[model samples]
Target: MLKNKGKRAYRVLDFLHEHVIAIIIAVVVLAGVISTIAIVKGDVKTSSEKENSIQYEEMSTIYFAMDPVKSLNPLSSQDRDVYYISQLMFSSLFKLNENLNIEPDLVSSYTANSGSGTVSIKLREDAKFSDGSRVTAEDVRYTVSQILRIGDESPYYEYASKIDSVKTSGSYSLTITFENPNDAALDNLVFPIVSSSSYDDSANKIVGSGQYAYDSYDSMKLLKLKPNTYYYGGVPQNRIQFKIIQDKTKTTGLMTTDAITAYVSTAQDADSDAEDKKLKVTKIPSSELEYLGFNFDNKYLAKKEVRQAIALAIDTESLIQDNYGGAGITSDSVYFPGFLGTENKGDFYKQDQKGASELLQKSGFKDSNEDGILEDSKGRDFQLTILVNSNDGSRSDTASSISEALNQIGIKASVKKVSWAEYRSEVRSGDFDLFLGGYQFDKKYDLRSLFSKSNYLGYKNDQILASVKKLETCISAEQQKETYEKLKTMLQEELPYYSLCYKTYSFITVKEFTSTETPTFFDMYRGCDTWKWKKVVVTEQKDDE
Candidate 1:
């Protein structure tokens, strides 16, 4: 048996030896196939892992201050904080620039026909509401209706009353009929436009077409906003959060506590934040006009040449630099710079003492007794008194400067710094020759009623009336600009009032952010979409055991 087993084993070994190469090759080929499958599986996994990997995204946010409990209705809310916040959540057909110029907003093109008392406006086709509804002619008309229904209670009542009616032709086409031919429809139509489809039920929801959409709000705490997806401007990772505090006086404190990001204020003094925590500021030119007025009822002041000579003698640039903290601008008129009438005009009221002296010499005025004081042809001394509010140090100082200038010109001039009551009484009674005063006009820049204002200056001029008539017929922007030049010329000839400067307000931000266009009161968030901001991180140290 052992011999047979050995012989079989030997025979199997001999057969295996003869085909050893084929066995080895078969083993290697099997290993290669298995390894190839494993490699293919590994490559598939690597590619799938790479395809699924992605960079995370972050949403940007802004924190601001507003009245917590007050209504956020843009049309009726009188709170300035509410007004400013509404600028973020609302859209207007027109917007005011930093220079107070009327610029198109929702409207792509507009044309006014003073002869027909109608204004045709073509809305931007891309315009939409926060609710993703297309902004239509009906929405504009509906907004005007709301403003009208609010009546005098709304801050926009004056502007809304100028529109006789709003008619819609198509989704983006509309016409506004003014109550009067001379009314500036483009200026008056700047009121905020809300969604007509939702306004009946969502008036208190603060929904409108703006840079941001309302996401959440707590009356006592905060108002959260989400991006308006329907907005065609651009898709950004931005959000807006409004901190609701009761008192306007607490904005600076909230900012100091790192609870808010930015705010709009009259000046740096308005913010009570610590000096170490400084804010980046952007100045907004206001429609407030600080001017020097003349009472034409005065005997010698009634003369055109005397008023012209006095206007030339007053040094406006020096007064603005000294008394105004160099924060104001001297437009050629009582109207604001870049306003309707002063857009293209030069600095006509600059100090020209030589010209003033020459004009005085030609106007039959002389120092009769060589006492250094000039007397009129009737032997009357060139005497005047400037009235100013005693409490307003800036105006008082400006009045004093004017008095000094008049005295330097050999005239007996003095400043009458009186109490508020006395100043108001004198101004209303027209009992003074000259008064230092200011007017805070709305975004429309309409001061036409000043032309007929009685007990103020007693200024009556037929040329002014004619110029106003001409301005009424202006329909296009070019025509308005041209007609305003005529009105400026008339004002120059009459010289009823001399413009000193327009006050400017400050907008402070926690981060270094800039706007695409100069900021204005009506549209402070004009270019907020592109506003680059950085989060201010504050490190707080806790107790260590």
Candidate 2:
């Protein structure tokens, strides 16, 4: 038995030695498969973690002093705050840059027929709505039609009123014909475009083609905006959050406490202490014209001599020095400084008390009762009330100053402070004798609203109206300049409104959100896409072991 066991062991050893190479090959192949499976599983796990670990590096918030009064719908909203936000959420056929030049936005290119008074716009194929739908000519046509249909109810009616017809030739091309040859037709096309389906229902959900889309609005307190992935301009890196605070006093506190990252204000709202804390304040000349409008229908103001006398009595230089700290540019022309019409520099009306008195006396106004107040021809005291909007302190102060100045010149004047709504109603209804107001002119400098026969002041001058008509459709730069110069001379003589100063707006932001571009009043977020937040991110890596 021992001898047979020994023989079996010897045979087993020989067989093992002969198949060693085949066994080694099998083991090596099995090990290779197992190692590949482990490596793939590890890679999948790392990719999943990386995909799920995205975190916001930084966040930004902006604080606006005024809250939007109505919905964010560009067509229906009349508030300036709404306009600012709408520019972010919607895209227009054209956009006014910081230089106030009209640049293409939604429209890739356009052609204007000067003789035909028609503009052909071709929509960009890449432009898309927030919902990822391609922006078509139908959307542009629908937006303009809605504005026209709403008439005066729509805030954009004034801009679109001249658009006689909007006809689309294809899905991406449209032509806009004007009732007359208006040189400002292209400028007026800056009105924002909405998705054609936005008006399908009564709800105010505005889907636009801008970089940002409306995320939510908590009444007057807050407005949250998110990036639009389909934005043709590319999405901004940081989301924008607008914190609306009607009280201007709390704005500084918000900035100091880091509750808000940015604020847009006038120069009067700037604080030296805030600047010490790395807050940057930038001032830009605004196109807003603050003036005093006269009711031409009033018997006392109807006379050209009386209106001119009043214009001469008020010291606009002192008004600017005292109220604006000599930081504004004063003008007598209806157009703001740097505009085409302002080149004439109508220096007819200046602070000349003697000249004012002479004009008043020639107009048959005298101190009949010797009570320091002038009397009209009929022996009635010459008293006028200057209405001012209570919300604007600078205008209110101007009204008071004018009242005091007029009283010194033997004219009894008073100031009436009223709410903005009441002020508008009174002016529109021709219920006020004189009022302090402001107007934002279009880039084309259209003066029809202030100088035409059917104007806000109920003014009617046939010659001025004709010049305005010619200015609107002149198309020739030289002719337009000549017409505006003539119109400015006529305005200086007429004295329908006393142009005081063009306002300036200051924007304050933290150092972390720095950008090279400066924003203008018309386009506050002009280069918002380039704004960046200062932050660092750390990403974890998988172990190779």
Candidate 3:
């Protein structure tokens, strides 16, 4: 009977196709037939009700939120969302772990010689691409070549620029030479490696050996992903989906509305908002260092005593609480606390009103007229103006607080807020006394580039730069850490720049997970490779009379 029904249905469809075009349309419309998704953006209702239908794995699945993708090519595009989704589909030789330490990913191990500026890497024999092909040393060479080909536009350019040459010893052994001795050679090799044989430069196709593989993509809606069967790492989530979000500000709304299950955000109120919605939010510390930049050329402002006094007057603890909502780590040193097995001596540079006054008096500055303002021995009036970008609410508030603190300490100060363009112009032109600045250091924490930039502030300190060079040549990690300690001490003593606090970001999710590793700023999806999921349990309760 079933076979007869199938034959009759086939015949009816064939007759309809040969007899009338309008009847065929009616049949398709009635049957809810869906066509293959095309590359287009609109609100057209797909017959399946969703664009690019997903094929789920036999295990668990997770939906993640990302901004609209302009291109799937992670190397060529400037989209952070694209970079993030690509991490799920691609594997790299080295990756930043939960503690922001560089560890081997696809490679078995590596040997570096700082004296020779060379590094030798051995790939994992079991490593394979999504196509089940062995990852060769040639592929590593090709990946670095592509990054260098993109010039400075590629985010990996800075890391790749130090690589003077790449030479493959065999199918799985490769050697990299740097322009000069670099202690961060291992950290610089954290870029993703692609299969040259499977990927085409002209096309935006991605072929990687990560935990997930490309399943399907609907132009303006969402991209579906399936598990990579050849993946060596354990697949925590069997399937994954990335919903296209054109506006990032709508992430919290979509999460509450069930449009997406999880997302990562740096917004100040992200944690609070998640609490209101009863969603799980993980607070993670980011590496973006927030600090105060000073113009050292001004004679009166160039005194170390004056800078130290100002630093003491500004309450860093209060700034972190008021401006950051207590979502930051306060520090007098620029380095992240406890990094590289380093120790911090308590009260090294905490706020002290008496200490601040003593420093000002030591600098030969005093309130000669007793009018709540300071003047030099020569009766020279002193004042400072802090420049901040108007778009950043937190930094703007910080500037205002610093201004008020200085006023209370008998030092005249004010804040100047401007658009991003004008802020940069004023700093570069040396038209400002002080400015609020932030730097998102690379995984390597390359301080050389930061110190070697053109003399925009006309700030000179040969001793500090020398210390950094020494830090680069240290052969052992222990020696490097010791050298960095010396460098941090010099920075504090010289007061070339002021170190403020490090901020934190939040990762909010609506789904229940059995287990998950902490994520870091270097890789927000650090847990995807090992995360375990659990089905949401629903309970029903009854009220009896």
Runs of candidate 3 with Cα error greater than 4 angstroms are: 1-59, 180-184, 235-238, 257-259, 325-327, 336-338, 341-348, 470-479, 511-516, 532-545
* Candidate 1, RMSD to the unseen true structure: 19.0
Off by over 4 Å in 1: 1-59, 108-111, 170-172, 201-203, 235-237, 246-259, 268-278, 340-347, 453-455, 466-474, 536-545
Candidate 3: C-alpha RMSD to true structure equals 17.0
Encode model 1's per-residue lDDT on 35-138: one tens digit a residue: 77877787434222332232222226767777754677788887776777777777788876565556788989988777878888999999788877899999
Ranking by TM-score: 3, 1, 2
TM-scores, all candidates, are 0.79, 0.63, 0.80
TM-score-best of 1 and 2? 1
Clashing pairs in 2: none
The Cα error of candidate 3 at residue 344, in Å, is 7.1
Query: Root-mean-square deviation of each candidate, in angstroms?
Result: 19.0, 20.5, 17.0
- Candidate 2, lDDT over the whole model: 0.76
- TM-score attained by model 3: 0.80
Give Cα-based local distance difference scores for all models: 0.75, 0.76, 0.76
Error of 3 at 404 (Å): 1.3
Model 2 over residues 226-342: C-alpha lDDT tens digits? 889999887777677877777765675676555766666665546454576667777666778888888888888999998888888988878877877554566657675644523
Kindly give the stretch of ten consecutive residues in candidate 1 with the minimal lDDT sum.
50-59
